[model samples]
Every structure is written in C-alpha cells, then in structure tokens.
Target: MNTPQLTESIKSLVDNIDREYILLPEFQRDFVWEIRKTCDLFDSLVRNIFIGSIIYGKPTFEITVREIDRRPRKGEGSRRKLKVISLEKNEINHKLQISNFRLILDGQQRVTSIYRALKGIDEIWYVAKNEDELSDEIKSKELRDRTLEEMLYEFSLQEDPDRLSIKLADAFEISKGIIPDDIREQYFEKLSFIAGMDEAEIKENFKRYYTICIKLGELFNSEVLISYYLLNMDNEKFALFFERSNSKGIQLNFIDILAAKLYKGFNLRDKIDELKDKYHPNNLDREIIVRTIAYLVSDGKDIDRNYILTNLNYNHFNRYWDEVCELYNKVLNFLFNENFIISQSWMPYENMVIPLIIYLRESEQKDFSQMTEWQYEFIKYWYWATIFSQRYSSGSNEAIIQDANVLKSITKGEKITDRVFFSRLKSQIDSYEDIYSYSKKVNVIYKGILNLINYDAKGLSDWNNSSKLTPDKKLEDHHIFPKDYIKQQFKNDDQALSLMDCVANRTLIPKITNIKVGKKPPSQYLTELKNSNSKLDITLKEHLIPNEIIEGLYDEFFTDFLEERSKLLFELIKRNVIDKEKSIIKEYYQAPKVKGNIKIFATYYSKKVEATFDIESQKILFLGESHSVPSATNKAKFYLTGRNNTSTNGWRFWKFIDENGEEKYIDELRKLSRK
Candidate 1:
C-alpha cells in the first residue's frame, strides 16, 4: 500500500505552481469562480481564515496538459492577470525531479486563486489599518462586513529598502517615526525611528500590527500553512481514486469523474468536447448529454447517476452520440423556427429539451412538422407550458421521468388532448407582465420571450437590411425609452426604475442599431429611420411598437405608452399562437438552507457583491455584516450602491449561489422553495 504525503505551506505550493512542477489534470473543470469570490478567498487568507486543505497525486504514467494561466475574463474586476510567470524547461524538470509532474486533484481553485491575487494577476486587496487609530466601525463586530475597497487603500511597493520602510510608515500613518526602543532592533532595523524612551515590551502590539501591514510579501514566502495529500499509484487505482476520492474542496463533477476513467481508449470529456466543437449548440452541457443518453437507454424511466455511469461505454456512447447530437440540432432548429433564436441566454429551461428529444427519438421524426398534427401540437404545448410554468425549476429528477412518460405515450399514438396536457401544466402567462428581469441572462422566461419577439422581428436590421438572428449574429435588446430618459422622467421611483427592465421597454434590434440609437427618444430614432427607409412604419408595426409612439405623438407619456404596448405585445402573441388555458397556482421552492459551505454573489446596478454562509451558525457575512438571509440582501444592496430603504427583493436581488454543483440563483430557489 502506498501512503500519501502532506505539504504544509502555501508558499511551497505556489512555488511548485510557479516552477510548473504542478499541472492540472485534463479532467479538471474550468476555473469558474467569479472574480468577487476570488477576492473573498484572498480576504480569508489575509485574515487567517481556514480555507480547507488541498489534495494532489502523482500518476504512474505521464500525461500532458497546459498550466492554466489565469487569463483575464470580461468584468473580472481584477486589472491584473492572475496567470503565472513563465519558467524555463530546465527549471521545471529540475524542480519537479521526476519525469512527470503531480496532478492537483483538489484545491485548484484555491491554488489558482492565491496565485492570481499574490501575483497581482487578480486585482484584490486587504484592508490596512494602523493599530493606534481604530474607527468605531472598525472596532465593532459589524466592521467585518466591509469590503476590501471600503476598508483598504491600494498602494505600490518601493524597491529601495529605506524608501520602502518610509513608504510603509507613511501608509500606516506612523507620525514622528515613533518606535519603542526595546522592539526597534527587531521591528525597525532596516530604517530609522524615534525612540519612545526605554520600552521593554515583548510581543509589542504596534510591532504586531505593523508586521501584518507590511507582510504582503509573505503570501509568496511559503510559510502560510496549506496541507495537501500527495498520492502515487497506478493508473487504474489513480483513476478510481480520481473518480471516488471525494476529497472535500472542489470535488469533481459527474462528467469530470467519468472523463478521468478511459472507455475503450477514449475519454468521455474529450469525446464531448469534440462533439461540442462540432455541434456547438447553446445549453449543451455534459450533464445534459449524459441525461439524454441515460434516458435513451432506460426508455425515459430513469436518468439516475448510477444509470449514466454504468452505461457510459464507448459502444453505448458511440451508438447514441450522433443521434443525440442530431436530436439537439432538431431541438435548436425547432426553437429557431419558433423565433427563439436559440442562445444559452434565450433558453428558458434546458431540461425542457429532454422530453422533446425523447419524443423525436421515439417517434423517428427528424422534425416537428414530420409528426402527426396531434403529435406536433402535443409536444409544442408541453414545451411552452413547461417553460412558462417553470415546471422543472427545482430540477426534480422525478419531473423528467413523469414528463417523458407523457411524451412517449404521444409517440405511441396515444392522443394528448388539451385536457391531458393542461392537467400536468401549472402556470400560464396571460400577459408579458408576468416576466421579470434578472442580473443573469440564463434561466429567465424573459429571455425565451425575447427570442419569440425576435421571430416576429423577421430578421430585419434596424436599417431595414435583411438580418438573420442566429448564435453568430449579434442582436441587441434596445430600450424603447432609454434609461437616462426613464431616470429623468421617474427620478427615484423604484417601481418605475424597475419598469425599465420590463419586457415592454425592450425590442430586438441589430447590435449596431442598439449602440447608434443610444439615449435617443423613440420618436427621434423613428424620424431618422423614416428618412433612411421607405418602410419604417411597416418595420415598427411588425416589431409591435405602438403607432402613437412611433409617430412621435405620445413620446413624452412613455410610462402610459409602455403599459399600452405591453398589452399590445401580449395580444399579438395570443392572436398568433396561444390557446386558452388557466394559470397554474405557482408554488415556489426555496433552496434548503445549505447544509455545508455556500457562497452567494449579488449584482445591483452593475456592481457585484459577495457573501458567504457559515453553515454551523446559519449566518451570512455580507459586505462585512453578519446577518440572516433577509438582512444579507439589504446589506449587500447597501454595500453595492450605498442606498437604504430601497425597494428590492432578497429572492431576486441576491442572484447567484456558488454551491459545488451547477450555479443556482436565489430566485430559482424561491420559486422552487418547498411549501
């Protein structure tokens, strides 16, 4: 039996990372932690908060993978790229000793996070305070809620040792160069300081404070404790350990684990990546593919984890891979035809694709039109109803089982009457007012609705040129009343400001048009449009724009104008597509109070704020204040924009939860909240 080894310093781990002695396994998921979370992790380290241990393993055979340089992503908040500095090949091989490097099984997030921050690749900072002067806020327990920006000042390092000492002293506001003589030799040796008479204090409080303030370099010192398990084993045992080790931090996802285990000389992840590059549809996650294959083999009775794991053979995967890919192609085509112009953002519910794929596979129909009229109507009704009602918002596996049964029966030539379809359905959208805007583009009914409007847009660019809305074609959602105009009209009315987000104010236009139309009143843009195109009136009418607003008559009364247009848009959809059905009594599902560690990110008015829930205490520390769910939301808002008594929904305001699995939103948890 081989024993695992533990390394006890972050500096050592980082040194290993710098020299390329550590390499991420190909099966490791992409670094998906939001920039804000990265900042919080740094804060934890500076405050000496216990982030869990890391795990690593040395494989028996060699494998090749590139070191993940923390490439800067859009809106990452960090100005610096957290990617590691390049090292010479000789240095890498020499430091590594062995021919192959160790694979980080766990703590990739932590390692990369620290590397990014300390290397200044990620722009993050800790609050600096002089021990002598402490504000009331800093003294209180609530001070912990303050963000790094709120509490810390950004500074630069000096190369000259004496100058650096003076720079540090000035930053810390050490006036008169006051220093206790007894501790001067230990704390102030490299620079000059005034004697504070005969001071024989050991563990001097001021010295300790200055030490922490000037210890930013220690992040690279290899002294901060970081425990990791290093295992050396054969590929089979290593793969098994890889799949089932269940090492605490950053556990592998199902696909990640499955990919680590080779199936007939092919890794599932590589095959999926190849499929993704080939097919490239929005919302095509590995889990979705696994579920589709799982359902295909089980005949829709199960999409269980064990079922997927056991059935992921090359032969099984190869047999169903192309067909599953074709089914997804069909799904996107059907959505495109419906004017959903399928992008990940425009997709209302990914699981909604499952039953349709099951129906297509069972019915042997390549397209919806190939289905019997009754069958086509049956599946269409189910798709829309499931989306509008959000029937699977909770991601209940049983719901997929039940929904698939209904579609399979339809494929069997059992007529799905409106009564039957409506029976399983739960909600109806009588008007566009039912839709709401969220910080994220995914998982919103409004996104689906926007695609529907795009369908009616008929691919006409704002300039009246032929434009096809596709994944490649950039389309922008233009505000009918520009935000500035709305703000001017409504001032501080929260309800009215929120109206700016309503579907009524938005229309699909080409990205160029959206940019050019900036802040122009609808009438002014329309006037310009009429000058350029003979059919401006026809284009506006087709887009569901009310004639009065386009004609420049009711431009000033935009509030009433938006309300009337929403009704008009609702009527347009009803007149074209929908059949009468009663709305379901919508039930909300709250995420069970997270049982373990959880991190939440909230965005308000384009600024991001983060909070962490202490599982044991059931308290969330937001912006520096510890509180319950309700107060966290309020505090997050205050920290984000510094406004209080502002109307906001905690459910909607606090957007994302970075639990171990798929990112979930508080809004979804609310709608899916158990009774």
Candidate 2:
C-alpha cells in the first residue's frame, strides 16, 4: 500500500497542491520554518541535492484537515487565523471528496517551501550566483533595523535597493515565454540595474540574459531532488503515525495537539499565560487546565485523556475558563488560610486540588468565604484524610472524580456514605508509623503536620524575632537537634544516627531564625533565644516544641527528646486534624507494613529488633516471636524508647534499612509499601 517514488517531480507536487489534490490534517501546527531555511531549501533544489523524503497519506477514509497557511511561518503574510471544517463524513466525502486527497504526513516544511517558490506566493525567491552571500548580507541588514523595502529589489516598489538579484517569480513567468513587450523591458531594466546599467554592457550581456532564463526555468521545473512515499492508509494507521509524529518529527503532548486542533477559536498558549498566578507563576499546569475543560464540557461525567481529545469543543472554553481559574484561586485561598498550602513549595500535588474544584462547582458556592463552619471542617477532614492516607499517590484520575462525588454529597449535608472517615480516618492517620518521623521531609503528610501546627497556633512565629512566619515567601524546615550534633554523638551507632531525621525532630520556622539558630543544639539555641526574648515559650508553642523537649537536649537524652516530640506530633494530628479538636497534640504511635522488603530491622541504640514480613500472611516474625506488624513494632518501640514510651502508635520506635542501604524508620518503609 505504498511506493517510495524517488522520481516524483517538483512539478507534480506543486500541481497537486495547487489543485487541492494534497491536504494537511486539521491538527497540523502551521508552518514552522524561517525565511533562511526556505532559501537554503531552494539552494538545495537548484543544485539537485537530496532533501528528506516527504510522506503522503492517500487515505480512503475522510479525516479532518485544513489548508496550509497562506504565509510562511516567519515571513510577513496574511494575519487571519484558520477555521475548522467539522462536517459529517458522508457530506465531507461527496462535497469535498476528501478521500481523493493526499495528506502530507511528513516533510511539510520542504513541500511548503518548494510550493511557495514555484507559485511565488509567500515571499520572493531570487536567482543570484552568490545567493548564500546575499542571504548573509540581508540577515546583517535585518539586524540593523533596515526594512525589506530598503534591502531587497521589489520591482513593484521601483526603488534602487542595496541588493539586486533576479526575482524567481518574474523569471518563471518569462521562462514560459509569456511576458509582454513592456513587462519584458521591466525585467531587463532590473537585470541591467544589477550590472550597473551601461548601454554598451546591456548590448554585450543580452545573450547571458537569455541563458539565465533557460537555465533557471529548467531548475524550477527540475525533478529527482525530493523523494516521496505515497501511503494508501486507513484511519487507525494514520493516528498511529501521528502519535509517533505529526507534521514535525518530535511528538507533542496532547495539550499541545489540542491547541492546534482549536486554532480556529482560541490561542490556548496565550490564554494560559493570562491564567498564571503565584502558585504557578511560569504557567499553570496545562493538563489540569485541559482536565478542567474536559470536566465542564462533559458535565462532570468524564475527564480522561481520550474523552477530552475526542469530545472537547470550543463552546465550553469561554464559558468555563474564567470560572475554572476563579474556582482554583478560591480553593488555593481556602488552603492557604488553613496553612494546608502556604505556597507552591508546600503543595503536595497540583492534581489533588481537582477534587476541591468539583466540590466548589457542584455546591454552587458563589463565594467560598460565605461557607459555614461545618463546610470548613468538612474540607479539613477531606484534606487530612487524603494526605495522611496518601490516596492520590499515582494514577488518580478516577479517584479524584470519585471523591468529588462524595464531597458533593457533603455540600448537601447528607448522610456520609463512606463511614470510614467518621470511624477510621483517625486510625488511617494513626496507621503510619512515621507520625513522629523527622528531618522535615516534604511529603504531604509531613507538610500536613507543619500545616496542623501552624493552623492550631494561628501561625508559626519566629523564635528570635517574635513575628509571624510567612512561609509563602521564606520558610525553612529547621531541625531541632542539628544533624551535626547527632552525627558527632552517634558516629558509630547506625540506629542512633537513623533517628535524627525523623519528622518529629524537625519544625517549620522562619529562615532568619534557622540561620541564627545555626548548627547549635536546641539546649544552646533555646537558652540563647530565651535569654534574649522573654516570650520564647510562645514561639516554641507555635513550632510544637515543648520546653521539656529542649530541656533534655544533652547527648544522653537525644532519644528522649525524639520520643517526646514524636508522641507530641502523633497527638497533635489526632487532636487537630483527625478529631477536628482545634489543637495539635496527642501522644500515640502505630506502624504499617514495609514496602519492597521481605525483612525490616528496627534499631534501638546498642540493640536491634529484626523482623521479616509475609504480606500474604499479613504477619511479622519478631526475633523469636510471630506477631502482627503493629504488635511487633509496638513491642520493639516500647523496648527501644525504654520505659518512657506510652501507648504509642508504635512504629516511631522502630527503624529499617531500605534497598539503597540507607537506614530508615519502619514508617518510611510503610510509605513505600503503600505506593
């Protein structure tokens, strides 16, 4: 169903394009070449050098298509945008005979260049022996603000320009022997001007003029430089061809392709630039914008890639674009107020907000500010439950839409059909063993903890300055026990060293305070801060740092401080987020299963509690005992924390080594297993 016709003449390609025997697909991005490339292309053709082969699809099925743009992509031409032709297949076939058309699947730039040159459409091509030097000189003049009128010889302009050469359009007409007496005289006048117009010289070079006409004419009608393959295709192969490549060799993402498809009514790239905000200053995520449009167009039923590709229409763009932006801003504002999202850096996933958009649209909330206390509380539950649960970790389109439906019911204050939130959301939150984990890891759960502390305290205050922390601008995930301090004290104890980075050991504070605090232990920094500032306790409260935790900063009590703060963090989530109790303190611990490992080792100073997991059995063999992961983790943690540990959620007391040979808390392994 194909032929590699190396013998396809330039004349045949041009003739077919002129008669509408060849077409371009509707989704093809308009010509992407500069005038220099066009000139280089002509230079290649005149010398009969091989350019890349163009592919033409002779499709028996009718596909949406548009004419090539009237102008080259770079040079000056028509300013109007293209329009789409959406018609029934039967009507398109009979009325336009699309099946008879050959679509240029590749080498669009090459074909378009030659077509423009032969037909003399977009820009004038010139015949000069030293065309490359002329092209370079013209480029120099362009950079110096000289107009094309001042640089090139336009016979219509009747001006003596700096660079004079034979215009191909005039030469083509003359070569066909179609010039009238006066027109032929005008051509000679331009040609003679290039030779400095001496009457004696004109008489001497008359035969050279005839030779130029014969040779250039043959060059214009020449064959064999461009090879083409004509493919007799069906719709499926045509689509596969486009997937690997479109008119260009590189594959564009769907959002880019959609922009081309909607070129008639919208300049999507320009529109998205207008939609930028602080959270996404460079540009908003294009896929989310497309997904929002897809959601609105399908009336909230579908937002998958294929559905949007085949179904998105222009009617909904204007209607939904502004509102989508508005709703997203409102959602961000709501999250910012609660400290769930302080800035772009604190955002867990951009797609996670899609559910909030669904809730806003479904509830028809005119202004999010007008929402009641119950609505705010509901959002907090959803936010905490999803983040702590790590639900939307990957491939979450269906989950987002599903949760959106559940949230819609919340707007109506209906029965919560998903009883897990009411009953076990706390347990789900409690299940992660790393609740006391530290090092200011920027996972949603870790950030969620920081948000919780900030929310409960109204805002995290600077320990040194006594001012509110503005994390949107500059915030640091400051460590209470500096990594240097821990490494110095426990240089040989891998288990002791492993506990330094637990989320419980870190706090969100202003960068200025962190810089002033430096690598000093909490005992040293807190004493220095307390001596200078009387209300250091108030700042400490904001960061979930208890006075006792700082009091025990000696080397012997490093584990003691970690144990206390981890318990405090565990209790804070349960009280503030899980319980909606308007606070950030509760002391508990629990551990979940490890990921990518059959065995996990929990470290406890000089000793260790090693365990192997059987996911199928859902059990852990602890040293000589067989127990559920939680029971085994609890026993090890309580024994490790050594008498200070209470009814902890438990996994915070344990540690494991990951595949990277790095020691981690069992809770980190739990996060991997969930993923």
Candidate 3:
C-alpha cells in the first residue's frame, strides 16, 4: 500500500481561508461545532496530535461558492464583481471567467474549529497545558486546590486567576514566522511562572517554561497536522466525489442537498441569487424555493421533509424553476403594490408564501395586473382568510399542501369541494370575534391582522398630519388608545395591557406621527385632529376604524373601544374577505335567478338521491347543509354507490326546474350565464 502523506500545516489552512481564496461552497451545511468540540479539536492540535485532513476541490469550471458564515458573507461585502455563472448543461456561459478557488469538500468541522480558535473569534477560551513541563507536585496540587478550575487540573495557578492555563491563541501568535513584539514578550513572560513564583524557583522554571512554549510553537507551525489530496477531476466526477465524502457527514438540509445534488448539473444557487438580485433586499428565503420545487415533484402529496428529499429529482427541477421564481415575485409585487406587505417582516407566515406561489404557478391567473376583479378578489380572499384563520399554524406542511390543492381546483374551474377546509376556515375566522384569545406576543397572527387592515389602505394617512403613507415612508403600528390612558383607566386589570396591544386597537400610523403622539390621550389627538383637518373621517375610514369606534377611543372607554373595534374589524374582514369567498364563481357566471331554494335531483345505478339548490346563496344544499354542486354530488354518489369521487362534473349531475317549468340539467344554467 502507498504511504499516507501530510503536507498542509494547521497555520497554512487557517491562513488560506478568506471568503474567496478558500471557498466554502454554498452546498456545505452550516458550522455545527459545539464549544466542547472546538476545545477538544484545538486541544489535539496544540498537543501535536493528528486532527484529520480537509479535502479541497479545485473546480476547473465556474461553480457556486459561499463565504464562511462568521466571515463577511455574500451581501456583507465579500461579494466580487462577478456575475452568477450558469451551470446548466449546454448552457454554461463560456465568456464568464472561472476563478481559481479551492472548495473545502470534507473535514469542515475540524477546519472551522481550529480556524475559529486561532482567530480568537470562538466562544471557548481554549487553555492548554505543556504536559511535558508539568511535575507531579503541580499536577497533584492543581487537582486538590479548591480555587483552581477542573479544566486545567495540571496547572497550580494562583487563587481566582482569570486565566487557568496558557492561552492557546497567544502560543499561536508565536507560531507565525513574523511574530509581533507584544505577542512574543507576553507569551514568554506568562510561561515564566506556572503559579505564584518565588525568587528562588523562578530562575529554574524559566528554561522549562520557555522550552514548553518553543515546543508548542514548533508543533503548531509543523506542516503535518492538516493535509489534503486535491480533487482535480472534471465537474461531474468532482460532484460525485463530493457526495461520497460529505453528504452524510453533517445533518442534511434540503437547500444544501439540492445545491450539492444539483451541483454543475443545474446551479441551484445561481437561480436563487438571480431571484434575490432582482428583488434586491427582499431576499426570499431559500426554503420557499425548495418547497415550491418539492411541490412540483410531489404531485399533490404531503410536502414534508421526508417526501421532499426522497422524491426530489434534480431532473424534475429543470422546467419549473424559472417559472417558480417569476411567479413568486409576481405574488410579492402584488403584495407590495396593494400595500399589504411590502417587506418580508410584515408577512405573518413566511411559509404561507409557498402554497401561494405554488397556487399561482398552477392557477390560470398568471398576471396579477391583468386579473379580472373576481380573479383578484379570489386571491385576496384566499390570502386574508388563510392569515386570519391561522390555516398554516399546525401541521403546516400538510395544511399548506392541502390549501395548494384547493387553490389548484379553483384555478382549474373544478368546484371547491373542500367542506372541511372552508368550514374550518370559517370557524377559525369567526372565533376571532373575541380577538383577545388567538395570539401571544407579536406572533404571525398579529402581523397578519396588520396586513389584513391594509385592505383599504390606499387612502391611509396619518392622523393630525396631512402627509399620506407612501411607499418609502416608515410606519409604526401605533396604538389607537394611548398605552398610558389604557393603563390608568384599567390600572389593575391585566387584560387591558394585552387588549391595548391587540390588532383591533392598532393601525399603521406614520412613525413620525407615533413619535409625536407618544403617551398623548386619544381625546387630545382627536381634538388636535378635529381642529387641524376636516378630512379626519376619510382617514378613519381608510384605516377601517368605524366612526363609532373612534368615539369610544375619544371618550377613554378603552375596553369598550377594543371590543367595538374588534367587532368592526371582524365585520370589515367578513365583508371584504369572508363573504367574498363565493365570488370566485362570478368569473364564469352571473348569479342565477332561481327564486328562493330550488330542489334538484340526480340518480345512478338503481339509487335515487335528492339535493336542494339554495337560490339565495347560489350553492347546492344537501341534507340541509350547503355545498357546491360537485361536493353535494360526490356526497350523494358516496351515499348511493359507496365510491368516493373527487372529479365528478357537478353541472351535469343534477336536474332543476327553470323558470319556464322545464326540467333541465344545471349545466344549462352554466351555458346560459357563461361570460
């Protein structure tokens, strides 16, 4: 067998890592070393022990690379003037320069541990003992000393000494060929004494201690601790080598998995940076892209971690990637223009964007600007209802995937047969009747309510100030009733503290206005507003604050204000979001003019079934419950035939009497009213 060779020194490896010179690939998992592991690794290094080799791949072609997380990463100014290189097969931009940088393919933990220790950036104060210089008396004394920490049991230092053992970082400074004066002198003087030095013993210990540090420097500077054989293969073979060496070593992240699996095969990071570069400061979370891709591969299944990683084929990532990026921005841009959530922080559930983007990809409404009012309304309804209902709060992966399916059906013009979805949504949204119960601190739901109230925010302006809320203006979630007022009125009542903070009494006021209105009673602000402007009504209406609710704020009935404002906001949501749910059908037809409830019937396979067409709501009523024609038909079919069918054509299933008293299929009404 060939002998194993070690060439790279620990100091060389640490010195080689700049963000660019030694590249940590975007595919590598984050630094996961505990402080103990860091201490142990450095302990081994200072002891002249083998700390393992770190493999580096010098790619011959342009590839994605990321900076060390602790170092100044991509946006923190380690960014080069380099354009993102396309790594898709047959699509490599040959004109782009392929920079020479070594990608660390293995032993990231050991490398990062030693690097952080020497740089003095890590948390653990790594203290090492020169075991060769220590005598049994010092060791025994250190062990039994009450004041000495157990960390450096070999060092019999003075009581309550800040440093127990010699600092490894100071010795590392001496390891360099160009030693700083402060470092060398400080290190040598510290080694002059192990503990309290008497004049008699100090001279004898000096040579032993100096030799101790000299030996430590020699060991640290030795070019034998870290060594690597360069991976000089072409891109294809190197990625394979990377997989074999590193894939299972760290806890796997799906983003890193795709970046690794799709290395040079597709350039996952390039596409991500493309989207981010376009959005410019609206940095989309990478997992959103992963989830969208997972949904593409999943084909209407549960979108959990196992399902995603197991089923993700980089081949399937080919066509859908560009479109997902485009449509995701479309949703974001719409939210921006509508004044709902201009930035990601305003979004309550970051994961909610996944189902929404997936829905847009599957939905027929591609352009938000061109959408018909009803099409736009459906999007708003889904968006607001999902938020107010906390639809993605628990079992979020399944919930989001299921909602994507429901949205997919709507896009396909298939009836929304999800009774469970809508019923749960309505129930949850209704429970917000007492808005105090659903939230804790400033959680997703709290942010969601702020986004919801932006429904009529076009005319939203500051109170007692004529300056309107523009795109660039900063905002504060101003308290409607001043905190001091609420506290004084209900000083002992604990509920007032939270109620005053709830969304019902909160609106996005200009930050400047909030600063001015600080601690001022609403009565004071209301009088100031009443004196300055006659258009106060317009501003109040714009914020969805009912005029009566404003009166409660003015009179200092803080509890009454929260209660009434909560009801008013809930009612507003009902009108703008909840009641608008069924308006999705307005895309295909005008509401049918069947007076009252029309009874309809359908039968198959010796089984006859009856259903009611509620003329008022324009939805089918089966067994006294309201459902779409498809839902009612499916239920009736399951009742008669025991077969669960999701794809039944609702319009062709039932017969109803028209105003002409002619028995006709409900399909006729669809035909007559088709837009």
Candidate 4:
C-alpha cells in the first residue's frame, strides 16, 4: 500500500538513469523494436524540437519498470516480491513526488530512447552528422561556441549547416519563415530548458511510473493481474512488451524449465549437452532427450502440464538434473563403451532389460570392463530384442518396470549364465512373432528358466561357453525388411509377413555397417565378419538362416528352430526339476474341450394340446406339441411345432402338423430331423 514517486527536469532523468532499471528478468524476452519504428520516434521528437513547439504534456511516452524486492523481513521466512511501476504524467514542479507518475504498463523502449537522446548519448537523427562530411572545426566545436541564431537555424533544417554550402543554404531557407522576435531571448530560453533538465527527471519518472501505476496495485500479491494484462493485449503489442519488459526477452521454454527441475542442483544443460555429445552426437534434439529423461525419472508420478510449462522452479530443476545426469551416465556406460562405437536403442522393453544388466553385473561381480565379449553380446541382444519387439512397448511404465525387476531377479549373478538367460530370451523373442498366437510364450519362458535354475545348475553350463561369444556386444537390431526397405517393398500389405520385423527376427551386428547390408542375404556380412575377426566360424547354423527366406520358407525355418530350441529347453527343465510333481509330463497333457448350448422357441395356437418327448444321449433332448383350434362343427384343424436340442455337435429333431382335421404322426419328420 506504500506509494512514492519522483519527477525532476530532463537533465536529472538522463544523469541519474541506472542500467539496472532497464533490465528485464531472466524470465522475460528479447529486444524486438523494428529499426524503422525506432527511427520514426527519433525523427518526430527532433522535428517537434526544431519547430520550437512547446513541450506540452508528456507525449504519451511511458515505460513500465519491474524490480525484484528482496529486502529482509521481520518474520521467519524470506519473501521475494516483484514491483512494477509506471511513468505517466509530467507535473508542474521539478520536485520528485508520486503524482508525477505515468501509466507505463509497457513501452519501456520509447522512454529509454527519449532518455538517451536528452543525455546526448543518442544522436537525434536530424543533428547526427557523418564524420566524412563534417569539417574538423564544426565536428570538434562545443555546443556553447555555436551562435544562438546559427544553432536555431541548424536545428530548423534537416541538414547540417556547418558541413557544406548546400546544407547551410538549406538551413537558411528553412529558418527564413521563423520570425525571430528576440533571437537572444529565444537562445537564453532554449539554453535554460536544456540546462534546467536533470538526470533525476527521467529516473524519478521511471520510479514514479513503476511505483504508482504498476507496483501500487496488489501485483506483488497477485501475479494473475499481470498475466491477465498480457493476455488481453494483441499479439504484436504484447510481444513488444515481452521483449522490452522482460530482461532481454529470454523466456525459458517448457522443456528448459523441465530440464532445470529434472536436473535440479546440477548443471543440467551442460550434462544434457555432454550426454548428447558422448552418446547421440548426431542427434542434437536436446528437448527430446530431456523429455525422455523426465518421463523415466517421473516413474509414473502424475505431473501437471502447467507445472511443467509455467511453474518450473529453479531448486526443483537442480535436484532433478542431478538424478537425471547420474542415470544418464549409468545408462550410457552400460550400453556403450568409452570408445562410443556401440549405441543402444531406447525401446520400452529395454526399460526392464537394462536394469537386468545392472543386476547381472552386481550379482556376477563383473564390472563392464570385466564382462566377457560373449556375455556382452548376449545381454545386448536380449535387451534390444525385448525393447523393439512391441511385446512390452505398449505396456505402462509401471508394468515395464515390474517386468524389468522380475527379469533382474531371474538373471542376476550365476543365474546370468548362458543356458538360463538365452533360453528365456529366445522364448521371449519367439513370442514376438505371434503376440496373440504365442500368448503364453513369456510366462512359459519365465517359468522354464526358473524351473531349470531351480534344479540342475549344470544344465545351463553350455550357454556359458566363451566360444559362443561375439566381440563388443555391440549389435543393433537389424531388420531383414530394413524398416525403410520394407516400407518401399510392401506398400499395400499392412498385415503382410513383412510387418513381423520384430526382435524375434532381429539380430545384432555392427551399427551403421550392418545397415549397409540392408535387406541383402546373410552372405553379404560374411566378408566383413571374416575381416573383423578370423576366429568367427560362419556355418549353416539353423538359427542363422538367410534373410531371403519368404513367407513359406520362414514358417518351416521358424517351426524347426522352435522345435529344436524347445527340445533343448525341455531337457534342461527336466534336469532341473526340484519338484517332480510340478514337472510337465507329456502323457498327462490333454487338449481343452469347447462347451456351450443353443435353443430355439416356437409358438402355436392351442385350445387343447397333445405333447410328445424323445430322449437322446445325456447331451440332448427334443419336445413336440400339437394343438387344435376351436370349431363350431364336429371338426377343427390342428397345428404342431417342435423344439429340439441344439447343443454344439448334439442331436436334432423335428415335428409338424398334417393338413388333416385329425392329428397324425409322420416318420418323414424323423428322417428330416437327421438331415
């Protein structure tokens, strides 16, 4: 409720002006005044001064000043307030007071420009002289040395009179119409106007404007008032205000704010840049990375969009940033080596899969550097396949996290050995082929691994063989259809087998180099494989079937592989059987039976009715009825209809009324029943 303002001459406005008053907050925008618009304001002021027009009421030039109030309080908590003051009216006295305040909700640029001009820091367009055009004497001369008549004449003309005869003649002609009542009197008067003006005039104007017009309202208590003002303004006008009023108009983006919160207490921007440079150098979309990190860190917490967009606080950003950086580093280190040759896709399945890696490393007592080449390859394949396979991608983050925890528990430590993880992973990969067709695959695989691990640990030893390992574990999920290749090849068939380009079919290899192999057959990478590692023994490994396998060929290959792996897995399960009662025996297995029933209703007119029923097996039964309509004479016609058993694969029966007045049964109905 406190109100204070000050107004002094123009001299005070310029001399006392502080750069801080012109600065917008970090949340504000940039300077956006067009050059032409600024030039126009300068030209108008100069022309009005040259015409000797009386400087009347303030020429509607106003500016809103905003300052952060961080003064210490008497209470326990530190309170931060924003003060907005406007400069509106020019008062009679030179004394500094609040009534001299002007309404400057915006327009900081115009006021600043005027203040600059009065201080001689800014050259009025008409008075500005080109260095090359001006004589040395005229350029170096002080304003006091110039004659009053000459100065007035120079001001009247739009050209510099001291430069050339052409400009001097122009000044003379322009001033010819101005009858000098008293040249000395006018000169003294103008000099007084310039000298009497003080720097405090502008400062006081700015202060009063800020204090009375803007800060005087309950703006410190309610931010909504300012927000409403901004919203009501037109886009261009508001944009201008945002530019000038906001310190340099550097508004933080939603992602920027979220990043700040996510990386709170840390240099989040730097961390993000570092990760991008280290892992995704070519993909510079920092916003996407930030969003992904935020999503991951939120861990299913409900977040408001407005909080992300507007209310992001610096402290929260710092904290979130630290956690994010730590997580990002862990992920990068696990997925890629220091050399940066290997990069993993961020598929949803990897959400659970990567955690398993951490669990494995911890359980196996192996740092990333100590992992065998084969172990790395196996883990990488499992992680990539699980992610891109679409099996776990559509699930909620909680579901994915839960599944990951389950995987970690199953694969951690000695349990991470080949036989256990691969068998489980292979089943998961196969399930991707027919998500619905192989609905039980994941559960089956999960159970199978648990079963095997529970029984004989040696059964899984073969998977631990170093000979089975590949180098660097840097395999990408190479699609046979080559996503792009498939898009081009199969334009019309949405359900075409090409759509089955999932982890089940995907295998890891060298990154971009493998992409060059495209949709080519496996033979294409054979040369590169030989060159990179001589120990690699390429063979007709049933699992290494060529990519050229068409739909018909794929079915056979898939079936064979499924059966072979299944047999190997089944043996492992048998060997590991801790509980013989729980073992799945072939002899005890039975196919499930289909069960349900259907019934039909028929209506008949009946004064008197006759009924007959026939029994079939326990699964079915039939009933027949006959009724006669009332007649005046001794005879009346009877109608008959029958309801029969309609159980699935059950028997059926039929009965109908004859055309005779007397009811009679027909064996033809029974024959028709069978048909």
Backbone clashes for every candidate come to: 18, 18, 0, 50
Q: Point out the higher-scoring one by lDDT: 3 or 4.
A: 3
Candidate number with greatest TM-score: 1
Residues 163-217, candidate 4: write the lDDT tens digits: 1111222222223343333422332123211222234322322232222212112
lDDT of each: 0.55, 0.59, 0.59, 0.32
Worst lDDT window (10 residues) for model 4?
645-654
TM-score of 2: 0.47
In the range 152-263, model 1's lDDT, one tens digit per residue, is 3222222111111223223222322435553344434433221211132112323433554334434434344442333654332343344433566555656665665545
What's model 1's lDDT at 440? 29
* Per-residue lDDT of candidate 3, residues 266-359 (tens digit): 7888878787788765667777877877887777675665565566666767867777777777777767778677346667777877766866
**What C-alpha lDDT does candidate 1 achieve relative to the native structure?**
0.55
lDDT of 3: 0.59
TM-score of each: 0.48, 0.47, 0.46, 0.28
- Model 1 TM-score relative to the real fold: 0.48
lDDT, candidate 2, equals 0.59
